[model samples]
Target: MPTIWLFAIVLVTGLAGFALARGRAVASAGGDTRVMHSRPLYHGLNGLLTAMLPALGLLVAWLILQPVLLDRAVVGAIPPEVLEDGAARSLVMADVRRVADGLDAAIAAGVATPEGLAALTAEDDVRGLLGQAGVALGSDVSPYVLEAARDMRATAATLRVVMWVAVLAVLAIGLGVALKRSHADYRARNFVERGVLVLLVAAASIAVLTTVGIVASMLFETVNFFSQYPASSFFFSTNWDPSFSGRGGGSELGIVPLLWGTLYISFIALLVAVPVGLLAAIYLSEFASKRMRSVAKPVIEVLAGIPTIVYGLFALITVGPLLRDAIASPLGLGNSASSVMTAGLVMGIMLIPFVSSLSDDIINAVPQAMRDGSFGLGATHAETIRQVILPAALPGIVGAVLLAASRAIGETMIVVLGAGAAAKLSLNPFEAMTTVTVKIVSQLTGDTDFASPETLVAFALGLTLFVITLGLNVLALYIVRTYREQYE
Candidate 1:
């Protein structure tokens, strides 16, 4: 059976078990209002958990493991010479999966029964037959590979049958146990709560686990990159250049220029976003009428809903040109339309709502009594806001700003379109420059050789970006924790 079908069966069984267990528990208490150890709802939930968790867990494991096991078995059956001399292993495995799927298609289309399909030789127009059944191979299938596909299909079919049996058996056993444990003194509520707590903890840990996994994968590939390229050249050199596969190997691959561009653009973005967003937030929270707040706040936040690509286009077609003509050119700076200022301004515009909306909510969340206390001390409105309200909201405002800074730092589309892909260490914001992210994309683009430092360098760049963002978050956390006030 298909996985979805198995899920439906499990769900239906669990629901049925719930009803049965709820009825059983009620009957055991003689339908008394207070005699049972737990409510009918808790008893039913206990039954549902019992029938679902073990069966679903097993099904999940089976789904993950079966493909891996089958692939290993089929790969072991293939001759090593084919992978060594013929083609890449990934291509060969892909062919194996495609052919297996073709055989199943042939069976479905009545080109051959499963028995006849197994008995057929690879020499007997296998490709044409599979084609007739709507699976086209790039080339002729070898006898061993054809046989391996057949074995894979056969083994997968058997495993599906086994998974079906095992999942159902577990479900049945669980329901039976729940039925047996449905007495008044069974403590069904406690069992149910414990199971719920375990599930909640698992859900909560997923983010941490995912972060660790991401860091580990990048670190491994980064280690691979560093093995081929010197760490000193990558970190200390000011250049950012990578040689093509045919151009021979003396690529500079320096990170300094890219890091400078990244920080420079981010600094400009923060400069634009922070004061504007914070002031807008303050106005909305402190000065706006209720009607204006409802309308204007959403209007301001609409910038957040606008796509970054759209902002990139705006930077390219509008903002970039405007800045070059109005400011850069008139000031005797470089007249390039695509410049650090162009991207930074556009990115800052994109990030405004991120800061403004968050800061607005945080400022509004400050206790009303704080403002009243300031007023009672004979402080003016502006003075009270500066001294009392802002300080009280400082931690949350810091968090909001940090969020905006992170967004600015990671921006890609605006940087790409507004700031031309010129990696350079320049003091002029009017000069075009590219960031680490843009280079990461460029290095990994097209048919890249994984063994080459050029491709592996993307992972290193990514790891560096991750570390930078992590440090920012840590710094923000330290600032917030250190300065946060305790309110009664």
Candidate 2:
């Protein structure tokens, strides 16, 4: 059965269990709710929780493990001669999967029967047969792959059958247990509540685990990179050059240039965004009437809805050229359209909504009594806003600014399209520069060897960027806590 069908079956079964257990509990209590220790709804929920969570969990686990186990088996059965040229087993496994999909498609197209596919050899025109099924193959199917595809299909069919039976059995057993406990005196409410609490805790733990997993994965790759490339050179040397020369050794994998570009562009972006966005927010929150606020706020926030790539294109096609022609060329700065200034200006425009929306909300959240108290103290509207309201909302504003800073630092598309990919240490804003995020993309983009330092360095760059953003977030949190404590 399809996975979706299995999911539907489990859900329907849980609902059925809920109805049955609720009816049984009510009947046991002679249809008198006061006589039962727990309500009929709680009894129903207990049955549903028991049957649904375990069966869904089991099905998810089965789906995750099935492919891994099958891939290992298929790879193991592949002949030694298939790997004589030392092609990656992963690539071969990909081919095997594609062949299996092709076989399925061919069967569906009625071009080949299952029995005929099983009897086919490497000498057969397997690619042509697959093409008739609309699957284009780069090369002819090998004997081992053909056979392994068949074996994989057979094993997968059996596993699916077994999985279906096991999941249904688990659901039935859980429902049976819930029904046994569905009497007049049992604490079904407590059991259901506890199960829900466990589920909530599991959901929270999964988030933390996902963060740990991301950091660990990048840390492992960063360690591999440092093992091959000297950490000192990567950290201190102010040069960025990655050699894609298949032989791969003589590249000066320095990050200082990239880091400088990232910081420089972010600094320029913040310089543009902070004042404009914050002032815009202040005006919208404090000065604008309800009618104007509703119309203008959404119009300004429409910038946020525009995709980053569209901003990148705006930078590429409009902002960069205009800056180059109007300022850079006239001032005898670099003549290139793709420059740090161009990317920063465009990125700042993109980040405007992140700051304005958040700051506006935070400012609006300040107590009305604070404003009234300032007025009672014989202060004018401007003075009250400047001294009372702004100070009260400062922490959240700082947080919003830092959040925008984090976003600016992580921007890739604007930097890529607006700031050309010339990694160098230059003071001129008119010169083309690249950020760490852009360099990470460049390094990992092509078909390259992963074992090489050049490729692994992308992970190191990624980890560095992650650490920087995390520190910014921590700082934002600290600012919010400290200021809020002092004032509140």
Candidate 3:
């Protein structure tokens, strides 16, 4: 909370600084001057950018680098024996911190000893020797725990005081400057507008940075996975029994069965969602009256707003049993609620609004001019819509469908409840089958061994799903871009 308050202060200070710089710049020009390319506001925004950019960058760098430096200093204080024994870095670090903490408590309680006191010794021999080693091999133990703590706290507090003072100082200064210049020729509005523009751009860039970070992290993990498991086994092996094998403990990695089940359920879901959703979109966008559209569009989209857990329960209690009795049992099939069809059907119902709402928007985007042109040629309303508008809007419709397919492939709850936990490859949708998402949830939702194949397999599955969705998104983008050319 203090950090947040500090940030707010810095932001306000920067904005005010910008506003002042802008007013000064504007005022320096002759009172009758109207020669600048942009409004005075742009100048103010530019000033804000200058003040805030370097300051914010410095703050972020300090936050990231401080922890690493402190950790290194803490690690250096451990005895040579602990360091030389080749223990895992994490375990060693944990022990060092524990020992240091013990010493601090002992020192406070006046119960220190050389053996027990070995952990928190500020002895010159230890400090000097560590410093020499660190200089020789970059492994110094700067005995500055107390000093570092004091400096860090003091520096943070100083920064806070500076931030608040700066904010109030700049705002008061900027307002004074602006008010002094507030004749009929003053340009306060221009300065404010420029500030708004810069803020919007900053907001947009955050989302872009986040997306890049996610993709980069996922890509690095996938590269590690491929190095461990052969691409052939991951992509083509039909079996997924990655049991603990031997003393060496490397389990086989296969993804084909998971992929098969994923595709099968998504296929069933699309088969149900496409016709129902597209028809609904067409009716809502083209056929429905204004009153019907206002009432029904929100109502249809409301299904999408329903939580997936609720849908999962519905699948488990209602749809799963109904399918078992009405369809599967009568067909001489196994009577399991947790079948591929049960999940797919329920998922399709959940996806109806996702498809329909998007399709409606794209369909509505079709120019009324095209409809008028068709009607002028004596085409009926149904034929005009079916033959002219739908084709014209096909790219957007296809994009919507692709997005829906990605959603279906990635869905977890419905499959968890209505698709059985069996990982068998099967042709019959009525037979139980598990999906990649379900398996990932099952594998990670408990006391998982990070080194175990069962747990690590989730990462591999995640990489696969990420790649597949990426491809679908790319394809959707391509279709949308291409279709935009048709109208042009």
Task: Order the candidates by lDDT, highest first.
Answer: 2, 1, 3
Angstrom error of the Cα, residue 220, model 2: value is: 3.2
Q: Which stretches of candidate 3 lie over 4 Å from their true place?
A: 15-51, 65-207, 242-250, 447-454, 477-488
lDDT of 1 by residue, 325-389 (tens): 99999999988999999999999888889889999999999999999989999999999889988
Q: Which candidate ranks first by TM-score, i.e. highest?
A: 2
Measured against the true structure, the TM-scores of the candidates, in listed sequence, are 0.86, 0.89, 0.71
Better of 1 and 3 by lDDT: 1
lDDT of 2 at 319: 95
Clashes of each: 0, 0, 4
lDDT of residue 301 for candidate 3? 91
Q: Distance (Å) between predicted and true CA of 231, model 3?
A: 3.1
**Candidate 3 residue-wise lDDT, 1-488, digit = tens:** 35676567668867876667666666666544475444666656555655565556555665666556545555444556655643234444543443344444444555544344344434434333333323121133335443333234334445556555554455455445544553334454575566677779979999999888877776665665565567787788787775545311555557877888899999999999999999999999989999999999999899999999999899899999999999999998878888999999989988898889999999999999999999999999999988999989998788889878989999998888888777888898888888899888876775444434456567778878988888888878887787768667
Pairs of colliding residues, candidate 1: none
Q: What is the overall TM-score of model 2 with all chains considered together?
A: 0.89
| Candidate 2 or 1, higher TM-score | 2
Q: How far is candidate 1 from the true structure (C-alpha RMSD, Å)?
A: 3.7
What tens-digit string does per-residue lDDT give for candidate 2 at 1-488? 57799999999989988998898899999999999999999999988998888999999999999998788667666977665533256567778899989999999999999889978888999999999999999888878888888888888888899999999999999889888888888899999899989999999999899999999999999997887788999999987778877535689988999999999999999998999999999899999999999998999899989988999999999999999999999999978999999999999988899899999999999999999999999999899889989889989899889989989998999999999888999899999999999988888885666767888899999999999998888888887888778676
